[model samples]
Target: MTIKEKEEEVIEEFSFFEDWMAKYEYIIDLGKNLNGYPPEQKTPENIIKGCQSQVWLHAYMDGEKLIYKADSDALISKGLISLLVGVLSDQTPADILSNKLKFIEEIGLNEHLSPNRSNGLSSMIKTMKAYAIAFSK
Candidate 1:
């Protein structure tokens, strides 16, 4: 699916939970389901800055598409990256660069996250976009 479609699907999924507690549970579940990351890829270069917990993100191009792999020491941070990876992976660099990722706001993630987590989320997005920029060249 396209990034927008994947994002909309996430938004719809989040809408089912009536409370933040349930939503947080779902996020943790999503984190649990993330594919295993390679130990070798957990280098300092892969670590996202400005996060309270260590978040490692790696990306590679599969032909014209970018595939992302990520892991975090913290549960919520892991889940947050999982959401981004689920939506942005397997997409072209241009597509990743162009999309604004409005679903983050739509799902109330921005409002619900703590200040540190929120900044971490922004760093994740920035790092993802930076990868896109590099790969697009």
Candidate 2:
């Protein structure tokens, strides 16, 4: 699916939850399902800055697409990255760069997250886009 389609899927999934608590639980579950990050790849260079929690993100180009692997010391942060990864992974760099990921606000994630977590989420997006920018060249 296209990035926009994937984002809409996320928005639809979040719409199933009747309350924010349920949505939060869903996010946690999504984190739990994330593919394991290789310990060796969790280097300082992979670490996302400006986050209260330690979030490590590694990206590599596969063919013309960028693939991302990420982990966070905090559960909520992990889930947030997992959400981003699900939407943005295995896509072309141009697509990743152009997409604004409006699903973040559409799903009410921005309002529900703590300020620190919100900043962390932005860092994750920035890191992912940076990877895309590098691969686009």
Candidate 3:
């Protein structure tokens, strides 16, 4: 699917929860499904700097698309990363750079997260985009 279509799917999935509590629970559940990151890859360079929790993100170009994989010491953070990876992975770098990922706002994720977690989320996005930028060449 296109990135926008993937984003819309996320918004739709999140819409199933009427309250933030249920939403958070669902997010945690999503976190459980992440493919574990390789322990050896948890180096300083892979670590996202701004997170209160240790969040590790990695991305690379596969043909014309970017493939992202990540992990976090924190459950919620992992879920948040999963949400982002779901939407943004397997897409072109130019496409990723041009989109705002407004679905984060659309899902009210920004309002529900703690300030530190919010910053971590932003850092993760930045890290993924930075990888895309490098490989886009």
RMSD of each: 0.7, 0.9, 1.0
Stretches of candidate 1 off by over 4 Å are: none
Tens digit of lDDT per residue, candidate 1, span 57-128?
Answer: 999999999999999988889999999999999999999999999999999989989989999999999999
Please report the candidate that would top lDDT against the real structure: 1
Which prediction has the highest TM-score against the true structure? 1
Quote each prediction's TM-score: 0.98, 0.96, 0.95
Please give, for residues 14-102, the per-residue lDDT of candidate 3 as tens digits. 88989989999988987888886777888888999999988888887789999888998788989999999999989999999998898
Tell me the lDDT of candidate 3: 0.89
Residue 69 error, candidate 2, Å:
0.5
Badly placed stretches (over 4 Å) of model 2 are none
Task: Compute the lDDT for candidate 2.
Answer: 0.90
Model 3 residue 19 lDDT? Answer: 92
| Cα misplacement distance, residue 65 of candidate 1 (Å) | 0.4
lDDT per model vs. reference:
0.94, 0.90, 0.89
Q: Could you give the candidate ranking by lDDT, starting with the highest?
A: 1, 2, 3
Worst 10-residue lDDT window for candidate 2 reads 27-36
Clashes of each: 0, 0, 0
